[model samples]
Target chain A: MRPVEVGHRGGERAPRSTRLLGRHELPIACEADIVLVRRKARSLAQAYGFDAFATAAITTAASELARNCWVHGGGGAAVVEELYDGTRHGLAMEFRDTGPGIGDVEWALAGGHSTTRSLGLGLSGSRRLVDEFALETARGEGTTVRIVKWKRF
Target chain B: MSPIPILRIGTTLLCSVHVELDDALAERLQEDVLGTIERTGATGLVVDISGLETVDSYVARILADTGRMARLMGADTVLAGMRPEVAATLVRMGFPLEGVRAALDLDHGLALLAHGRSGATEGRRPGRTAP
Candidate 1:
Protein backbone atom coordinates (compact mmCIF):
# COMPACT_ATOMS: atom_id res chain seq x y z
CA MET A 1 0.00 0.00 0.00
CA ARG A 2 1.36 3.39 -0.96
CA PRO A 3 1.30 6.15 1.61
CA VAL A 4 -1.58 8.62 1.25
CA GLU A 5 -0.61 12.27 1.11
CA VAL A 6 -3.06 15.03 1.99
CA GLY A 7 -2.60 17.94 -0.37
CA HIS A 8 -2.55 21.55 0.82
CA ARG A 9 -5.93 22.04 -0.77
CA GLY A 10 -7.44 19.39 1.55
CA GLY A 11 -7.64 16.84 -1.29
CA GLU A 12 -6.00 13.44 -0.98
CA ARG A 13 -4.25 11.73 -3.85
CA ALA A 14 -5.01 8.11 -4.56
CA PRO A 15 -2.27 5.66 -3.68
CA ARG A 16 0.38 5.00 -6.30
CA SER A 17 -0.82 1.41 -6.69
CA THR A 18 -4.42 2.49 -7.28
CA ARG A 19 -6.11 0.92 -10.29
CA LEU A 20 -9.48 1.69 -11.84
CA LEU A 21 -11.94 -1.19 -11.46
CA GLY A 22 -14.98 0.27 -13.21
CA ARG A 23 -16.46 3.51 -14.50
CA HIS A 24 -19.91 4.93 -15.24
CA GLU A 25 -20.85 8.29 -16.73
CA LEU A 26 -24.24 9.84 -15.92
CA PRO A 27 -25.78 13.02 -17.24
CA ILE A 28 -27.22 15.68 -14.94
CA ALA A 29 -29.59 17.64 -17.15
CA CYS A 30 -32.47 17.99 -14.70
CA GLU A 31 -33.66 17.15 -11.18
CA ALA A 32 -34.52 13.57 -12.12
CA ASP A 33 -30.92 13.09 -13.12
CA ILE A 34 -29.94 13.85 -9.55
CA VAL A 35 -31.89 10.82 -8.32
CA LEU A 36 -30.25 8.61 -10.93
CA VAL A 37 -26.78 9.82 -10.03
CA ARG A 38 -27.41 9.41 -6.31
CA ARG A 39 -28.75 5.87 -6.70
CA LYS A 40 -25.82 4.87 -8.86
CA ALA A 41 -23.43 6.14 -6.22
CA ARG A 42 -25.32 4.31 -3.50
CA SER A 43 -25.23 0.95 -5.29
CA LEU A 44 -21.58 1.38 -6.22
CA ALA A 45 -20.59 2.19 -2.66
CA GLN A 46 -22.55 -0.73 -1.28
CA ALA A 47 -21.03 -3.07 -3.85
CA TYR A 48 -17.60 -1.84 -2.85
CA GLY A 49 -18.34 -3.06 0.70
CA PHE A 50 -18.84 0.33 2.24
CA ASP A 51 -20.79 0.15 5.48
CA ALA A 52 -24.26 1.61 5.76
CA PHE A 53 -23.07 4.88 7.28
CA ALA A 54 -20.39 5.32 4.66
CA THR A 55 -22.82 4.41 1.92
CA ALA A 56 -25.28 7.02 3.09
CA ALA A 57 -22.56 9.64 3.18
CA ILE A 58 -21.47 8.73 -0.33
CA THR A 59 -24.99 8.95 -1.76
CA THR A 60 -25.80 12.19 0.04
CA ALA A 61 -22.63 13.83 -1.20
CA ALA A 62 -23.38 12.65 -4.71
CA SER A 63 -26.89 14.05 -4.50
CA GLU A 64 -25.69 17.47 -3.36
CA LEU A 65 -23.10 17.74 -6.13
CA ALA A 66 -25.49 16.49 -8.77
CA ARG A 67 -28.10 19.01 -7.68
CA ASN A 68 -25.55 21.78 -7.94
CA CYS A 69 -24.72 20.67 -11.46
CA TRP A 70 -28.35 20.82 -12.52
CA VAL A 71 -29.37 23.96 -10.64
CA HIS A 72 -26.27 26.13 -10.52
CA GLY A 73 -24.06 24.69 -13.25
CA GLY A 74 -26.95 24.66 -15.74
CA GLY A 75 -26.32 20.95 -16.45
CA GLY A 76 -23.29 18.64 -16.43
CA ALA A 77 -22.12 15.04 -16.38
CA ALA A 78 -20.94 12.83 -13.55
CA VAL A 79 -18.28 10.10 -13.85
CA VAL A 80 -18.39 7.48 -11.08
CA GLU A 81 -15.60 4.97 -10.81
CA GLU A 82 -14.25 2.33 -8.49
CA LEU A 83 -10.58 2.31 -7.62
CA TYR A 84 -8.58 -0.36 -5.87
CA ASP A 85 -5.24 0.06 -4.23
CA GLY A 86 -3.04 -2.76 -3.04
CA THR A 87 -4.72 -2.67 0.37
CA ARG A 88 -8.05 -0.81 0.15
CA HIS A 89 -10.91 0.04 -2.20
CA GLY A 90 -12.17 3.52 -3.06
CA LEU A 91 -14.98 5.21 -4.91
CA ALA A 92 -14.26 8.32 -6.98
CA MET A 93 -16.81 10.61 -8.56
CA GLU A 94 -16.29 13.58 -10.83
CA PHE A 95 -18.99 16.16 -11.64
CA ARG A 96 -18.30 18.45 -14.58
CA ASP A 97 -20.39 21.23 -16.07
CA THR A 98 -19.97 23.92 -18.72
CA GLY A 99 -22.44 26.34 -17.25
CA PRO A 100 -21.79 29.92 -16.22
CA GLY A 101 -19.17 28.73 -13.75
CA ILE A 102 -18.44 30.21 -10.33
CA GLY A 103 -16.87 33.60 -9.84
CA ASP A 104 -16.29 33.14 -6.09
CA VAL A 105 -15.54 29.56 -5.21
CA GLU A 106 -14.27 30.50 -1.78
CA TRP A 107 -17.59 32.07 -0.92
CA ALA A 108 -19.45 29.12 -2.32
CA LEU A 109 -17.47 26.76 -0.15
CA ALA A 110 -17.95 29.00 2.83
CA GLY A 111 -21.48 27.66 3.18
CA GLY A 112 -24.88 29.39 3.32
CA HIS A 113 -24.15 31.25 0.09
CA SER A 114 -26.23 30.53 -2.99
CA THR A 115 -26.70 32.00 -6.43
CA THR A 116 -30.24 30.75 -6.80
CA ARG A 117 -33.07 29.97 -4.42
CA SER A 118 -31.26 27.22 -2.54
CA LEU A 119 -29.84 26.59 0.92
CA GLY A 120 -26.32 27.09 -0.50
CA LEU A 121 -25.11 23.95 1.28
CA GLY A 122 -24.13 22.04 -1.86
CA LEU A 123 -20.41 22.72 -2.15
CA SER A 124 -19.47 23.07 1.51
CA GLY A 125 -21.70 20.25 2.75
CA SER A 126 -20.71 17.77 0.05
CA ARG A 127 -17.06 18.38 0.82
CA ARG A 128 -17.56 17.67 4.49
CA LEU A 129 -19.30 14.33 3.80
CA VAL A 130 -16.48 12.75 1.78
CA ASP A 131 -12.92 11.63 2.43
CA GLU A 132 -11.34 13.61 -0.40
CA PHE A 133 -12.76 16.68 -2.12
CA ALA A 134 -11.38 18.92 -4.86
CA LEU A 135 -12.97 21.63 -6.97
CA GLU A 136 -11.92 23.27 -10.23
CA THR A 137 -13.73 26.19 -11.78
CA ALA A 138 -13.24 29.25 -13.98
CA ARG A 139 -15.56 32.15 -14.55
CA GLY A 140 -17.65 31.55 -17.72
CA GLU A 141 -15.83 28.24 -18.25
CA GLY A 142 -17.83 25.95 -15.98
CA THR A 143 -16.81 23.83 -12.97
CA THR A 144 -15.64 20.36 -12.04
CA VAL A 145 -15.85 18.73 -8.60
CA ARG A 146 -14.01 15.53 -7.72
CA ILE A 147 -14.58 13.48 -4.57
CA VAL A 148 -13.16 10.20 -3.30
CA LYS A 149 -14.41 8.00 -0.48
CA TRP A 150 -12.17 5.18 0.72
CA LYS A 151 -13.58 2.05 2.25
CA ARG A 152 -12.73 1.57 5.89
CA PHE A 153 -11.34 -1.76 6.95
CA MET B 1 -43.43 12.56 -12.64
CA SER B 2 -46.20 11.81 -10.15
CA PRO B 3 -46.34 13.69 -6.88
CA ILE B 4 -46.10 11.96 -3.54
CA PRO B 5 -49.43 10.69 -2.26
CA ILE B 6 -51.16 12.19 0.79
CA LEU B 7 -53.78 10.28 2.74
CA ARG B 8 -56.20 11.85 5.18
CA ILE B 9 -57.06 10.11 8.44
CA GLY B 10 -59.55 11.91 10.61
CA THR B 11 -58.07 15.40 11.04
CA THR B 12 -54.50 14.49 10.04
CA LEU B 13 -52.87 14.20 6.60
CA LEU B 14 -50.41 11.34 6.12
CA CYS B 15 -47.75 11.70 3.39
CA SER B 16 -45.51 8.70 2.95
CA VAL B 17 -42.52 9.55 0.76
CA HIS B 18 -41.15 6.32 -0.67
CA VAL B 19 -39.52 7.38 -3.97
CA GLU B 20 -36.76 9.79 -4.74
CA LEU B 21 -38.12 13.32 -5.02
CA ASP B 22 -36.85 15.66 -7.68
CA ASP B 23 -37.10 19.42 -7.19
CA ALA B 24 -40.30 19.72 -9.21
CA LEU B 25 -41.93 16.80 -7.44
CA ALA B 26 -40.89 18.08 -4.05
CA GLU B 27 -42.44 21.44 -4.85
CA ARG B 28 -45.56 19.70 -5.99
CA LEU B 29 -45.76 17.89 -2.66
CA GLN B 30 -45.67 21.20 -0.80
CA GLU B 31 -48.53 22.58 -2.89
CA ASP B 32 -50.56 19.39 -2.65
CA VAL B 33 -50.22 19.12 1.12
CA LEU B 34 -51.17 22.73 1.66
CA GLY B 35 -54.10 22.48 -0.72
CA THR B 36 -55.37 19.34 0.98
CA ILE B 37 -55.09 20.95 4.39
CA GLU B 38 -57.10 23.92 3.15
CA ARG B 39 -59.78 21.72 1.63
CA THR B 40 -60.04 19.09 4.36
CA GLY B 41 -59.00 21.35 7.24
CA ALA B 42 -56.43 18.87 8.43
CA THR B 43 -55.24 19.77 11.89
CA GLY B 44 -52.04 17.73 11.64
CA LEU B 45 -49.59 16.66 8.92
CA VAL B 46 -47.32 13.65 9.31
CA VAL B 47 -44.62 13.04 6.67
CA ASP B 48 -43.16 9.57 6.68
CA ILE B 49 -39.61 9.40 5.28
CA SER B 50 -38.66 5.89 6.35
CA GLY B 51 -38.46 4.62 2.78
CA LEU B 52 -36.17 7.43 1.66
CA GLU B 53 -32.55 6.39 1.30
CA THR B 54 -31.17 9.87 1.23
CA VAL B 55 -32.20 13.40 2.28
CA ASP B 56 -29.96 16.05 0.81
CA SER B 57 -29.99 19.78 1.55
CA TYR B 58 -32.54 20.54 -1.16
CA VAL B 59 -34.99 17.89 -0.03
CA ALA B 60 -34.40 18.78 3.61
CA ARG B 61 -35.33 22.37 2.88
CA ILE B 62 -38.51 21.32 1.14
CA LEU B 63 -39.55 19.17 4.09
CA ALA B 64 -38.83 21.89 6.62
CA ASP B 65 -40.58 24.53 4.55
CA THR B 66 -43.59 22.28 4.12
CA GLY B 67 -43.83 21.80 7.87
CA ARG B 68 -43.66 25.53 8.51
CA MET B 69 -46.29 26.24 5.89
CA ALA B 70 -48.60 23.63 7.31
CA ARG B 71 -48.38 25.31 10.70
CA LEU B 72 -49.39 28.64 9.24
CA MET B 73 -52.47 27.00 7.77
CA GLY B 74 -53.61 25.84 11.24
CA ALA B 75 -52.01 22.42 11.13
CA ASP B 76 -49.14 20.84 13.06
CA THR B 77 -46.57 18.89 11.05
CA VAL B 78 -44.52 15.92 12.23
CA LEU B 79 -41.70 14.40 10.16
CA ALA B 80 -41.37 10.75 11.01
CA GLY B 81 -39.33 7.63 10.16
CA MET B 82 -35.99 9.16 9.20
CA ARG B 83 -33.29 6.55 8.84
CA PRO B 84 -30.34 6.87 11.19
CA GLU B 85 -27.85 7.24 8.39
CA VAL B 86 -29.98 9.87 6.70
CA ALA B 87 -30.27 11.75 9.95
CA ALA B 88 -26.50 11.67 10.43
CA THR B 89 -25.92 13.02 6.94
CA LEU B 90 -28.45 15.81 7.48
CA VAL B 91 -26.67 16.82 10.65
CA ARG B 92 -23.37 16.85 8.79
CA MET B 93 -25.04 19.01 6.15
CA GLY B 94 -26.01 21.49 8.93
CA PHE B 95 -29.78 21.28 8.55
CA PRO B 96 -31.11 20.74 12.06
CA LEU B 97 -34.72 20.84 10.82
CA GLU B 98 -35.55 23.68 13.20
CA GLY B 99 -39.14 24.80 13.66
CA VAL B 100 -40.40 21.33 12.85
CA ARG B 101 -41.43 18.39 15.03
CA ALA B 102 -40.33 14.84 14.26
CA ALA B 103 -41.23 11.36 15.52
CA LEU B 104 -39.59 7.97 15.33
CA ASP B 105 -42.28 6.19 13.28
CA LEU B 106 -45.74 6.50 11.83
CA ASP B 107 -47.47 5.34 14.99
CA HIS B 108 -45.56 7.87 17.05
CA GLY B 109 -46.35 10.60 14.55
CA LEU B 110 -50.05 9.92 14.76
CA ALA B 111 -49.82 9.80 18.54
CA LEU B 112 -48.18 13.23 18.57
CA LEU B 113 -51.04 14.57 16.51
CA ALA B 114 -53.54 13.06 18.90
CA HIS B 115 -51.73 14.50 21.87
CA GLY B 116 -51.75 17.93 20.27
CA ARG B 117 -55.49 17.74 19.66
CA SER B 118 -56.28 16.66 23.20
CA GLY B 119 -53.96 19.34 24.57
CA ALA B 120 -55.67 21.96 22.40
CA THR B 121 -59.00 21.35 24.10
CA GLU B 122 -57.48 21.16 27.57
CA GLY B 123 -55.41 24.31 26.84
CA ARG B 124 -52.65 23.33 29.24
CA ARG B 125 -50.14 21.04 27.47
CA PRO B 126 -47.08 22.53 25.74
CA GLY B 127 -47.46 20.67 22.46
CA ARG B 128 -48.18 22.30 19.08
CA THR B 129 -51.88 22.69 19.63
CA ALA B 130 -53.74 25.63 18.20
CA PRO B 131 -54.32 28.41 20.68
Candidate 2:
Protein backbone atom coordinates (compact mmCIF):
# COMPACT_ATOMS: atom_id res chain seq x y z
CA MET A 1 0.00 0.00 0.00
CA ARG A 2 1.04 3.59 -0.61
CA PRO A 3 2.47 5.57 2.27
CA VAL A 4 -0.32 6.73 4.53
CA GLU A 5 -1.20 10.43 4.52
CA VAL A 6 0.42 11.34 7.83
CA GLY A 7 0.60 15.08 7.25
CA HIS A 8 -0.99 17.64 4.95
CA ARG A 9 -0.94 16.69 1.24
CA GLY A 10 1.65 19.42 0.63
CA GLY A 11 4.25 18.06 3.09
CA GLU A 12 5.09 17.86 6.76
CA ARG A 13 3.40 20.47 8.91
CA ALA A 14 5.33 23.72 8.90
CA PRO A 15 7.33 24.36 12.07
CA ARG A 16 5.75 27.77 12.53
CA SER A 17 2.83 29.32 10.64
CA THR A 18 -0.06 31.76 10.89
CA ARG A 19 -3.65 31.23 9.85
CA LEU A 20 -7.04 32.66 10.62
CA LEU A 21 -8.66 29.82 12.50
CA GLY A 22 -12.17 31.08 13.13
CA ARG A 23 -14.47 34.08 12.82
CA HIS A 24 -17.67 34.93 14.61
CA GLU A 25 -20.08 37.62 13.47
CA LEU A 26 -23.02 38.12 15.76
CA PRO A 27 -25.27 40.93 16.83
CA ILE A 28 -24.37 42.02 20.35
CA ALA A 29 -28.01 42.55 21.14
CA CYS A 30 -28.50 40.07 23.97
CA GLU A 31 -26.55 39.28 27.13
CA ALA A 32 -26.17 35.63 26.16
CA ASP A 33 -23.56 36.44 23.58
CA ILE A 34 -21.09 37.21 26.34
CA VAL A 35 -21.16 33.63 27.54
CA LEU A 36 -20.93 32.34 23.99
CA VAL A 37 -17.85 34.39 23.24
CA ARG A 38 -16.12 33.32 26.44
CA ARG A 39 -16.77 29.65 25.77
CA LYS A 40 -15.50 29.95 22.23
CA ALA A 41 -12.28 31.51 23.43
CA ARG A 42 -11.69 28.75 25.95
CA SER A 43 -12.24 26.07 23.33
CA LEU A 44 -9.87 27.72 20.87
CA ALA A 45 -7.20 28.22 23.50
CA GLN A 46 -7.43 24.62 24.64
CA ALA A 47 -7.25 23.30 21.08
CA TYR A 48 -4.08 25.35 20.58
CA GLY A 49 -2.44 23.95 23.78
CA PHE A 50 -2.63 27.14 25.78
CA ASP A 51 -1.63 26.51 29.39
CA ALA A 52 -4.26 26.87 32.07
CA PHE A 53 -3.09 30.31 33.11
CA ALA A 54 -2.85 31.46 29.53
CA THR A 55 -6.28 30.05 28.83
CA ALA A 56 -7.76 32.04 31.68
CA ALA A 57 -5.96 35.19 30.60
CA ILE A 58 -7.07 34.91 27.01
CA THR A 59 -10.63 34.22 28.07
CA THR A 60 -10.66 37.30 30.29
CA ALA A 61 -9.18 39.41 27.51
CA ALA A 62 -11.81 38.17 25.11
CA SER A 63 -14.53 39.04 27.62
CA GLU A 64 -13.31 42.61 27.91
CA LEU A 65 -13.01 43.06 24.14
CA ALA A 66 -16.36 41.45 23.43
CA ARG A 67 -17.99 43.58 26.08
CA ASN A 68 -16.64 46.69 24.39
CA CYS A 69 -18.04 45.46 21.12
CA TRP A 70 -21.44 45.11 22.70
CA VAL A 71 -21.60 48.17 24.95
CA HIS A 72 -19.62 50.75 22.96
CA GLY A 73 -19.62 49.52 19.40
CA GLY A 74 -23.32 48.63 19.43
CA GLY A 75 -22.18 45.33 17.84
CA GLY A 76 -19.17 43.70 16.20
CA ALA A 77 -17.40 40.48 15.33
CA ALA A 78 -14.16 38.70 16.28
CA VAL A 79 -11.47 36.58 14.66
CA VAL A 80 -9.20 34.12 16.49
CA GLU A 81 -6.00 32.88 14.95
CA GLU A 82 -2.87 30.93 15.69
CA LEU A 83 0.62 32.37 14.97
CA TYR A 84 3.14 29.62 15.45
CA ASP A 85 6.07 31.29 13.70
CA GLY A 86 6.20 34.23 16.09
CA THR A 87 8.92 34.59 18.71
CA ARG A 88 6.93 32.04 20.66
CA HIS A 89 3.77 30.01 20.22
CA GLY A 90 1.16 32.73 19.87
CA LEU A 91 -2.54 33.35 19.62
CA ALA A 92 -3.90 36.48 17.99
CA MET A 93 -7.37 37.83 18.57
CA GLU A 94 -9.00 40.66 16.63
CA PHE A 95 -12.22 42.42 17.47
CA ARG A 96 -13.66 44.82 14.88
CA ASP A 97 -16.66 47.05 14.92
CA THR A 98 -18.21 49.74 12.74
CA GLY A 99 -19.54 51.97 15.45
CA PRO A 100 -18.41 55.46 16.42
CA GLY A 101 -14.66 55.15 16.94
CA ILE A 102 -13.11 56.31 20.13
CA GLY A 103 -11.72 59.85 19.89
CA ASP A 104 -9.03 59.62 22.57
CA VAL A 105 -7.09 56.43 22.24
CA GLU A 106 -4.62 57.40 24.93
CA TRP A 107 -7.29 58.23 27.47
CA ALA A 108 -9.17 55.10 26.61
CA LEU A 109 -6.06 53.00 27.09
CA ALA A 110 -5.46 54.52 30.47
CA GLY A 111 -6.44 52.39 33.40
CA GLY A 112 -9.68 53.36 35.11
CA HIS A 113 -11.12 54.74 31.86
CA SER A 114 -14.58 53.76 30.73
CA THR A 115 -17.49 55.47 29.01
CA THR A 116 -20.01 53.32 30.86
CA ARG A 117 -20.32 52.44 34.54
CA SER A 118 -18.07 49.48 34.03
CA LEU A 119 -15.24 48.42 36.32
CA GLY A 120 -13.06 50.86 34.30
CA LEU A 121 -10.36 48.20 33.74
CA GLY A 122 -11.17 47.13 30.23
CA LEU A 123 -8.33 48.14 27.92
CA SER A 124 -5.45 48.37 30.35
CA GLY A 125 -6.33 45.21 32.21
CA SER A 126 -6.75 43.28 28.98
CA ARG A 127 -3.44 44.54 27.69
CA ARG A 128 -1.72 43.27 30.82
CA LEU A 129 -3.04 39.79 30.05
CA VAL A 130 -1.25 39.48 26.78
CA ASP A 131 2.27 39.91 25.29
CA GLU A 132 1.35 42.37 22.56
CA PHE A 133 -1.71 44.55 22.27
CA ALA A 134 -2.69 47.08 19.61
CA LEU A 135 -5.69 49.29 18.97
CA GLU A 136 -6.65 51.15 15.80
CA THR A 137 -9.60 53.49 15.44
CA ALA A 138 -10.75 56.36 13.27
CA ARG A 139 -13.58 58.87 13.37
CA GLY A 140 -15.69 57.04 10.80
CA GLU A 141 -13.75 53.85 10.26
CA GLY A 142 -14.82 52.23 13.54
CA THR A 143 -12.47 50.39 15.93
CA THR A 144 -10.26 47.33 15.96
CA VAL A 145 -8.39 45.67 18.84
CA ARG A 146 -5.68 43.09 18.30
CA ILE A 147 -4.02 41.13 21.08
CA VAL A 148 -1.28 38.50 21.03
CA LYS A 149 -0.16 36.11 23.75
CA TRP A 150 2.88 33.80 23.70
CA LYS A 151 3.18 30.41 25.24
CA ARG A 152 5.35 30.46 28.31
CA PHE A 153 7.16 27.86 30.36
CA MET B 1 -21.88 27.01 29.86
CA SER B 2 -22.72 25.03 33.00
CA PRO B 3 -24.95 26.73 35.52
CA ILE B 4 -23.96 27.24 39.13
CA PRO B 5 -25.09 24.73 41.72
CA ILE B 6 -27.45 25.53 44.57
CA LEU B 7 -27.42 23.35 47.67
CA ARG B 8 -29.94 23.27 50.48
CA ILE B 9 -29.03 22.22 53.99
CA GLY B 10 -31.87 22.51 56.48
CA THR B 11 -33.09 26.12 56.15
CA THR B 12 -29.85 27.42 54.61
CA LEU B 13 -29.23 27.74 50.88
CA LEU B 14 -25.68 27.47 49.56
CA CYS B 15 -24.89 28.49 46.00
CA SER B 16 -21.56 27.49 44.45
CA VAL B 17 -20.63 29.44 41.34
CA HIS B 18 -17.76 28.62 38.97
CA VAL B 19 -17.66 31.39 36.36
CA GLU B 20 -16.70 35.03 36.30
CA LEU B 21 -19.40 37.18 37.89
CA ASP B 22 -19.91 39.69 35.12
CA ASP B 23 -23.08 41.65 34.38
CA ALA B 24 -24.69 38.81 32.49
CA LEU B 25 -24.19 36.17 35.21
CA ALA B 26 -25.08 38.65 37.91
CA GLU B 27 -28.47 39.36 36.35
CA ARG B 28 -29.20 35.68 35.95
CA LEU B 29 -27.95 34.89 39.45
CA GLN B 30 -30.13 37.58 41.03
CA GLU B 31 -33.24 36.07 39.53
CA ASP B 32 -32.32 32.49 40.43
CA VAL B 33 -31.21 33.21 44.00
CA LEU B 34 -34.24 35.35 44.72
CA GLY B 35 -36.55 32.74 43.26
CA THR B 36 -34.95 30.01 45.35
CA ILE B 37 -35.26 32.05 48.50
CA GLU B 38 -38.92 32.67 47.82
CA ARG B 39 -39.70 29.08 46.92
CA THR B 40 -37.83 27.39 49.74
CA GLY B 41 -38.33 30.00 52.45
CA ALA B 42 -34.65 29.63 53.25
CA THR B 43 -33.55 31.40 56.40
CA GLY B 44 -29.95 31.94 55.31
CA LEU B 45 -28.04 32.43 52.04
CA VAL B 46 -24.43 31.44 51.46
CA VAL B 47 -22.69 32.21 48.17
CA ASP B 48 -19.46 30.31 47.58
CA ILE B 49 -17.19 31.70 44.89
CA SER B 50 -13.93 29.81 45.40
CA GLY B 51 -14.20 28.64 41.81
CA LEU B 52 -14.72 32.09 40.29
CA GLU B 53 -11.83 33.40 38.19
CA THR B 54 -12.85 37.04 38.07
CA VAL B 55 -15.52 39.58 39.01
CA ASP B 56 -16.29 43.16 38.00
CA SER B 57 -17.98 46.12 39.62
CA TYR B 58 -21.43 45.26 38.36
CA VAL B 59 -21.12 41.79 39.84
CA ALA B 60 -20.04 43.14 43.21
CA ARG B 61 -23.10 45.38 43.22
CA ILE B 62 -25.30 42.46 42.29
CA LEU B 63 -23.91 40.33 45.11
CA ALA B 64 -24.48 43.14 47.59
CA ASP B 65 -27.96 43.53 46.28
CA THR B 66 -28.56 39.82 46.66
CA GLY B 67 -27.48 40.05 50.27
CA ARG B 68 -29.81 42.98 50.82
CA MET B 69 -32.65 41.12 49.17
CA ALA B 70 -32.12 38.11 51.38
CA ARG B 71 -32.06 40.31 54.48
CA LEU B 72 -35.27 42.00 53.51
CA MET B 73 -36.87 38.60 53.16
CA GLY B 74 -35.80 37.69 56.74
CA ALA B 75 -32.74 35.70 55.71
CA ASP B 76 -29.10 36.32 56.54
CA THR B 77 -26.53 36.33 53.72
CA VAL B 78 -22.92 35.21 53.99
CA LEU B 79 -20.24 35.18 51.29
CA ALA B 80 -17.96 32.19 51.38
CA GLY B 81 -14.80 30.94 49.66
CA MET B 82 -13.76 34.18 47.95
CA ARG B 83 -10.37 33.55 46.33
CA PRO B 84 -7.55 35.94 47.19
CA GLU B 85 -7.14 37.10 43.61
CA VAL B 86 -10.83 37.72 43.25
CA ALA B 87 -10.83 39.67 46.50
CA ALA B 88 -7.85 41.75 45.39
CA THR B 89 -9.54 42.52 42.08
CA LEU B 90 -12.68 43.64 43.89
CA VAL B 91 -10.67 45.96 46.10
CA ARG B 92 -8.82 47.44 43.14
CA MET B 93 -12.07 47.87 41.28
CA GLY B 94 -13.41 49.87 44.25
CA PHE B 95 -16.32 47.63 45.04
CA PRO B 96 -17.22 47.65 48.70
CA LEU B 97 -18.22 44.20 49.92
CA GLU B 98 -16.94 44.57 53.46
CA GLY B 99 -20.24 44.63 55.31
CA VAL B 100 -21.27 41.29 53.90
CA ARG B 101 -20.25 38.39 56.10
CA ALA B 102 -17.47 36.34 54.49
CA ALA B 103 -16.13 33.00 55.63
CA LEU B 104 -13.13 30.94 54.67
CA ASP B 105 -15.15 27.92 53.73
CA LEU B 106 -18.68 26.59 53.46
CA ASP B 107 -18.47 24.77 56.80
CA HIS B 108 -17.33 27.92 58.55
CA GLY B 109 -20.10 29.92 56.90
CA LEU B 110 -22.70 27.40 57.94
CA ALA B 111 -21.42 27.40 61.50
CA LEU B 112 -21.51 31.19 61.64
CA LEU B 113 -25.06 31.23 60.34
CA ALA B 114 -26.02 28.62 62.87
CA HIS B 115 -24.44 30.58 65.71
CA GLY B 116 -26.14 33.80 64.59
CA ARG B 117 -29.51 32.09 64.51
CA SER B 118 -28.94 30.58 67.94
CA GLY B 119 -27.87 33.91 69.38
CA ALA B 120 -30.91 35.64 67.92
CA THR B 121 -33.15 33.04 69.53
CA GLU B 122 -31.54 33.17 72.97
CA GLY B 123 -33.86 34.58 75.74
CA ARG B 124 -36.58 35.21 73.14
CA ARG B 125 -40.28 34.45 73.41
CA PRO B 126 -40.85 30.71 73.59
CA GLY B 127 -43.46 30.74 70.81
CA ARG B 128 -41.31 32.55 68.27
CA THR B 129 -38.32 31.19 66.26
CA ALA B 130 -35.40 33.17 64.87
CA PRO B 131 -35.53 33.52 61.11
Q: Best by TM-score, which number? A: 1
Chain A of model 1, TM-score against the native? Answer: 0.91
Q: Residue-wise lDDT of candidate 1 within B7-107, one digit each (tens)?
A: 99998899999977777878898999999999999999999999988888888899999999999999999898999999998888777577778888898
A10-46 in candidate 1: lDDT tens per residue? 3456768899999999999877899999999999998
True contacts kept of 1: 0.78
In the order shown, the candidates' DockQ scores are: 0.68, 0.14
- On the 0 to 100 scale, the lDDT of residue B107 in model 2 is 75
- Candidate 2 per-residue lDDT, tens place, B55-85, comes to 5445666787889988899889888887675
Give lDDT: candidate 1, residue A7. 26
- TM-score for candidate 1: 0.89
| TM-score, one value per model | 0.89, 0.67
The CAPRI-style docking tier of model 2 reads incorrect
